[model samples]
Target: GTDMGTARALRRNLEAGADSFPQDVVELMGYFQPAGDGQRIRAVPGEGEQVPIWILGSSLYGAQLAAMLGLPYAFASHFAPAELDHALEIYRSRFQPSKQLDKPYVMLGLNVFAAPSDAEARLLFTSLQQAFVNLRTGRPGRLPPPVEGYERDLDPMAKTMLGRALSCAVVGAPETVGQGIEAFVQRTGADELMVTAQIFDHAARVRSFEILADVHKSLSEAA
Candidate 1:
């Protein structure tokens, strides 16, 4: 749910019917403390060992808090990217060096669909396109099987919007995959990159990640 509609609202709604749902909401709140003392409690190290904590967000709020807390930051750019760069800038500039980390570390989330051929990769990518379109159209469900010419079906405006929203994504053959990852790294200088693929075909999905891993390894070696 959106930030405005937090666990409190869900808990309130569930109170009329089920008592257990409200308690579950309370437990969820303890685990998902975004602000206040509860958030600090989540950061506390247990026993003699140090605990590493990371703040996850697609907007500047998490970046600001992560900077203040001196924790690693992970941006959910794969879905929400409107504030990605701005959040990165805020995080790096306002970061306070902590005992656990000496400098700001940023991890960017990206989507990639890699295959032996560009056409094949694009066919695989249609699954994600369908899902995003479904979500935007208010009919989201388990990713339906890929539909050929799905982009053609969408009006020009949705196509443009999706292209912008998924700008961080990379979908292509081996050469294209290598170039895309290389360019992304050069552009963002991200400490780490997390790639996600939403493909309905299990075999194709595994191959997609395998291609990504091989491309990453080859790039690292050549570097």
Candidate 2:
């Protein structure tokens, strides 16, 4: 997420040079609002190629801009679920359809972890969940080893939110996880799901995608 000048320059280069990239998709990070004079988003004058910019925000500001501009919006709900509902409501209610779309298109971030079994998935998730806890406690560290027990130690509220957040996540066994994710996609009506999975084992991380692909195939067959 660069400044407006950078964005404009990049677009210019892409337009002038090789046409390998798509200039229409300008994914903007809404968190980096300009600080002072000449720093505001006015840098992006909402013109030139009419770049389809999507305000990526974890709060309301992004939603407001998306609505005003009649553009799409993406929420970082995976890591920051606290403001999800409010952000979604603001974006939808204020949305004004543009020529590009008749309705607001919203996307949510999600953390996904897939494994052979529920027990194994939980074991693999320990490292990733611990990383989140570390971020919260300001003691960030590399993915740690899978601990023997964390589900039993976490508080009920924390556990509940984590479970809900991972409802379409950290699911185990291809069949079960596949069913869970299908249900999630159906219920959320999400056009796209951005997944961020954290696994301690590098090889295991690669395998997660393979498992996910298989699950997707299984679900499609069922449908």
Give the TM-scores of the predictions, in the order they appear. 0.79, 0.70
TM-score of predicted model 1? Answer: 0.79
Question: How many clashes in each candidate?
Answer: 0, 0
> What are the lDDT figures for the candidates, one per model?
0.81, 0.69
Those runs of model 2 whose alpha carbons end farther than 4 Å from true positions after fitting are: 1-50, 155-168, 221-223
As for candidate 1, its clashing pairs are: none
lDDT of 2 by residue, 1-223 (tens): 4476768865675676424222323323221334345443433544233445676787777787777667778888776666777777788889988765679898877666788887787788788667766666689988787787987898887676666554435457776677767766776666777876788888988887789888778777878
Q: Write the per-residue lDDT of candidate 1 for residues 64-105, one digit (tens) a residue.
A: 877876778999999888899899999999999977578999
Task: Indicate the worst ten consecutive residues by lDDT in candidate 1.
Answer: 38-47
Tell me the deviation in Å of residue 122 in model 1: 0.9
